[model samples]
Target chain A: MSTLQGAGVHGAASWRITRILSLRWIVWGAAAIFFLNLLGVIAVVIANSFATHWFGSWLPAGWTLKYYAQSWQNYQLSGILVVTLQVAFAAVIVSLLIGTPAAYALARRNFPGKRLMMLAFLLPIMVPPITYGIPLATLLYKLHLGGTLTGVVIANLVPPVPFVILVMTPFIEQIDPRIEAAARMCGAKTWQVFLRVLAPLLVPGLLAAALLVLIQTVALFELTFLVSGPGSQTLVVALYYAVFASGIRPAQAISAMAVIYMLTTLVVLVVTLRYVRPTQMVGTVR
Target chain B: MTLSETPVASEAIAGPERRSLRHRLADRGVDRLLLLSLPASLFVLVFFIYPSIYGVVLSFRPLKPVGAFGNYTHFFGDPFLRGSIVNTFRIALPAAIFNVLAAIPLAVVMRGAVKGQRIINTILVIPISLGTVLVADGLLNYLGPNGWFNRVLMAAGLIGHPLQLLHNQWGVMLSLVITGFPFAFLLTLSYISGIDPKMESAAATLGAGPWRQFWHVTLPLLVPGLAITFCLSFVLAFSVFPSATMLGNPNGDSHVLAVAAANTAFQQYDFPMASTISVIAAAIELLVIGAVLGLRSRFYAGTTTGKG
Candidate 1:
């Protein structure tokens, strides 16, 4: 196929074939451009975070570590990081607690209204958070639960619970039902069966789901932004406020905060990637 | 055997006489396991479904306690408020389209064996974890008039002046494309890779060229997945909030509906009005999703893979 047939193919046909093959080059070129820009977006932040000063130049004038320190103090990042971790871990625990059971039931049982129940789990994942987040925030505020860690945790729980259910449902299904039946036949109660048989088998799936939820909660901006108060701001929200606030914060400080946020989520994401397929994060709906 | 048989015999005996709901459900292959889903169902009911319904209800009640449709009227009557829908579409439609379009060729290329596939995927997925806020922050620095993008272009003598990439509609669009592309790409990759490769080989044996094979064998099987991908991406882009604010002129060209809704709720302290805009935004989003999915049904849904 690579060699153009000289005997039968005319000039136009050969040229067309050559052009089509060159499409590969075109594809690679576009991809390269995309990756370059993406890297630039990330690299520029890391660069500016450590730069002493930067203006109309290719690189920062000089590099220093002071902005990271300054941003740590100026943003009260220690408190913000604690809140972020609290919200993330809380979301993971609460979501796993509820979602894993639903996933098990959905996987093992085919009751009436099963489709509707699955749809209920799916709606939160399918809908963008901002649409539901506004009302969710309003509801939380009306209940006087807004502007607190509990509110932030509850708001973040909306997506991951469904996420866990969807993700773990398949994982649960992949486990042999005969194993469960054998455990049940051995005189183990339902909870005992879950504890002894399912839990051990489900640890990997659970850890992956929990880590995904942790990464999502850390990266999740809209829901937390809507419900969180001044003190309840996660790292993402705090970075947003630092950037959005009126004061002319040096670009270095904001970039430093962004780098910190990036590191936190990326660290969790790296762990998540270890257990879960990257495609699973987005394609769980299918 | 009798011990197991005895339970079944007793259930059979108990099935007809004074059957309670629990017995009825158990007879139909449901039992306490089904009940396990109740907590999650209740949680979703209270937080997700209920809030959505409440928001719709609240939209009808404005802050001033006027007529039922006060907030809706207020939203539609104000030109600035109403124009945000148009502005949002202006940003969202293009971002979604570009993301899906750019994703398709790359997805097709990456579906087969590629070198450093894991590393490539890791790099691609990084922006996702970085989130939009960081992406916007990064864009402001990298694509700002004085930043490296313009600097590099200047050094190459590409233009006389640094282009206005940020603080405009273009900046928001750029950020959306950067963030939205990975999502579209991953979804499309999964969909495309799910297709059987032998279909293309089959087409090739019939004297079809690469383009012919893709057009006839691949694309027909891919349309439905693409439609869904487009819908999902469109929904995500339609709700552009943080990036639109940070990268673009929020009050001017980039005044998306989300920004308007957020501003109403937070800045103006009008929760009802915010709910009104949120409802409208959701309605519009659902309409698009429905229309796309509806169109997808027109395509052949026999099987996703070409094996069938």
Candidate 2:
């Protein structure tokens, strides 16, 4: 026997079907609005950088590259860029040196206290940095490590090392153990197997981790702001200082600098997405 | 040396054969793992653990070498400073919940094969890299009185006056959502996609509707992921300093925990008091995290299978 079409036969109950349909549309419409505003905020900033006067209008009053020039001149983009690069590169190298092996160990060998080890690795990245940053900065200050580039690098390492380990552990686990046995059968030692058999396979993962650490170090503001000295400011910290800096500068000029920051991060992000899924950056935390 | 026998079942047979010549070398590497992991342990120990402990201990030290609660009492006992604790949770709890909720439907939509998926994803993830400070600046211009949002509302005659959106807790909340949403969305989308789509399809074949399939089959598996994201987003919001100062009413109740900790430690040069606030902030954060995780496990009931 065929089932009756209750929704079509019952005229009084027709609103149930319609209600479901309309509710679907309402949900989608809400999602669309959220997506637009998310992108809209970023667009507004990029547009405002070029705007001469942007009040009371959907678009800017006038547009020019003059703010870019002003931002470059006043912000010392050249110097800040150099420091940002140095700090990011140094942090990545240190994190990789320490993180990759730890990842390999965690991946290859199951041992006692493994869960505790993983939890320990997770805590630095999991807890808000500001909670520990206050004390970390104080310690650095006491040891005269604060406000130096070295101090900034040390502080930045607290999170990204865990990140590298988190990202790399999965990659290491994905490699077939049989391949390592083959390399061993050919008379390669553990270090040799890792360097030769594993290094080539791990390059892609290491690159992803490095890029993530790079962007993280670049974008990291709180720890850097706490510990960095006048000479050690990264692009983000400099931008924070510039936001509240004395004197009236054009919004376009500040937005110009923000645009520069956005471009640098975006370029690296595009490169990162090529190597790793966005899911890998986030969902792998567990 | 090679294996003595090529067994039909690999791992099952290999489980008892750890004494092979090649196994020794692999074991050596495994042993070296402890050595290899040393630098990270030292790094975290020196920079992270020691300082955190010092900060906690220092918070308990009294300014006058009096009672153990002197430092905490000096701040928490005072009415003006104590309000910051309430203010911090007020901003954090709702903002965290909002970000996680916003991420869920967006993740659902993104999971579908939408047009311009890559471009859309790139745009969505951009805010993750924008950091809180940049978003605050953007809002100060975009959501500010003269910025695009207000201008649009005014041009359309939707309101007679400019809405008070900036320089308040609301502005700070806006920045947190902007930064927090993308992060929570990315994680949620990953977790949802990780769920076996066949499970939902099976429910559909069993005469379940879309909403019913989602509520019954998918929602149970999503609890753990959502819990972790909520905790993370909440932590991100709780440690509000720059955004609170830049976009919030500094003189108002929104002067949150981290900002207060920073002011006590740095501006006031009261290291003990600052440490005390940091400890309190951390305790509150851990408490919230514990409650969320406990609820999450109860809801999830060990059904999660996405762990790598």
Using TM-score as the measure, the top candidate is 1
Q: What is each candidate's fraction of native interface contacts (fnat)?
A: 0.75, 0.62
Model 2 pairs in collision: A147-A229
Candidate 1 ranges beyond 4 A from true positions: A1-7, A10-17, B1-16, B19-21, B301-308
Model 1 agreement with the true structure over B198-222: per-residue lDDT tens digits = 9899989988888888887888888
Model 1 in CAPRI terms: which quality?
medium
Give the per-residue lDDT of model 2 (tens digit) for A1-286: 0132343657424554566667667767976776777767888989998888876677888888899998999989989999988998999999999999988888888766778888888999998889999899999999998899899989999999888889899889999989999999999998899889999999999998998888788788899988998899998888888887725777788889988988888888888888866666666666
Best by DockQ: 1
lDDT of all predictions, in order shown? Answer: 0.89, 0.83
The residue pairs in collision within model 1 are none
- Can you give the lDDT of residue A276 in candidate 2? 68
Instruction: For model 1, report the TM-score of its A chain.
Output: 0.94
